[model samples]
Target: MSKAFSAIDEDREVDRDAFTPGVEPQPTWCPGCGDFGVLKALKGAMAELGKDPEEILLATGIGCSGKLNSYFDSYGFHTIHGRSLPVARAAKLANHDLEVVAAGGDGDGYGIGGNHFMHTARENHDITYIVFNNEVFGLTKGQTSPTSPKGHKSKTQPHGSAKSPIRPLSLSMTSGASYVARTAAVNPNQAKDILVEAIQHDGFAHVDFLTQCPTWNKDAKQYVPYVDVQESDEYDFDVTDRREAQELMTETEEALYDGTVLTGRYYQDEQRPSYQAEKQSRGDMPEEPVAKRYFDDDYEWERSFDVIDRHK
Candidate 1:
């Protein structure tokens, strides 16, 4: 075949090794970064899903996790800080067939974009939201974030943090996300399982990954490492039971610094209708950009400039 034809075929079909090379430039992450685990799990999940690279839209916010977009050969958008959800929701609404994923670090998702996170879950859009929870802000050179543990010291908190850490899993559960999960970056297999399941869910899904940032969270060596599933019994994973999941999130009796990585689904409800699926069923899908399917003829001028000129 000609070189042009070969190139065309390559675009039409994914190369087996395309995603295998993984993130480019070998990831500038510091030694023992949790983002690495999440990346592997994401690639594995995408491979398992067997979807076209173009059909996958990985939207990310500014942070260490945002850099993930650069590595994947699939369609990716590196949006402003805390804005990934809005973009992902829009993408999914525009093209219901696309597999949209919103990913970002804790600060990006819970700090600046905290409000958006809540609304996104309540909306129940058909998109996957993954938060890389490292406790500390690794990108801003070791700063305290919303999820930073109380009494945790950082450049921004010289005398230990004073504010309470935001419990993302519990918050998402209460926010009405149809699916919720928490996984350790160390457990690539389990992470893949949880992510794929979340993506397959019809409504909004959330997967919070507790990863280590050795450079920023000085206690990385004491807390982060490979996942020990058999030993994770101490961490509650009764996802079907919201009260139990909330208890687990609040019960930090065995914190990561104590050497127990939390992993498992927190909640799931396949029955919940996705934002797009519900709209399509009710014949509420927007036919024009400005309004829904039942827009009045007066709005025709908005759809075409030529029509307005001819009418004038």
Candidate 2:
């Protein structure tokens, strides 16, 4: 039996009057949280992409950044800690038409959800993963996170963080993500542009924003100052060339310590096939063998055959 269904193509049209004042609820971050800029960038990117807020799906994990979903007017999932990717992936698989975005703080993504991050990139799912790299876990009260620099003292790492900070851009490039980019929360224009590019990209697009958590990460200002914004010359790296992307990652690391901030799309591939391609590529849904064998009029025979097949 075939079932009739109707889908609302709400995303195709934009409502100029759709957004009301304070549509996006104010996030519950500290007074001067860098996540505010990240949120603004995302909203700006969505507007730039002409995506209807009703047609968007934002999934977030538990953290300061996770609270972001509550502020957006789109369909959102405030998932358990370190599980934003699965929620976002499931949403996309269920409805490939919607623009699915997963977001969380560095601790939520890189520390607990690091495995999921790897697999998600490898699968090359057509979704955008935004990481707010604040270096410290602000929600859990000023603990050192995975991206926290070595020798950075925090509540959890008072004597200084033991391990080195994880290079998210390099990790993303190595994970087979079709698109990878990095920007700072302070640079909203560049951040919005990168986010827009990531959202429009075919496969898994990872955008890591170095955000500042004033309440927790006091030293974050050294890299991302509130008043002083560092600008770097844009280097055009062949996104399709993996070697070139890797070299760019190395150069970016050097630039970071040398006090030059890197921004813009570091990697991308327009030719990569999206996740929806597999299901859509099938010639057509197959007919049941039982239907072709006249099983509709012979349920007893079909049931016997099913039992026999199962035993075999």
TM-score of each: 0.81, 0.82
Model 2, residue 97: displacement in angstroms? 0.4
Question: Native-vs-model 2 lDDT?
Answer: 0.76
Cα lDDT for residue 33, candidate 2 = 80
lDDT assessment of candidate 1: 0.76
Candidate 2 lDDT by residue in tens digits, 1-312 = 211011224335443333223554655788878888887888888777767766788999998888887776677899998999999987776666678899988999998999999989987888999999888888989988887777889877889888888888888878878898888887888888889888888889999887878877777673553221224335555767889888887787556645566666777888877655644566322222222333245444535555443543
| Per-candidate clash tally | 0, 0
C-alpha lDDT of all candidate models, in order: 0.76, 0.76
Clashing pairs in 2: none
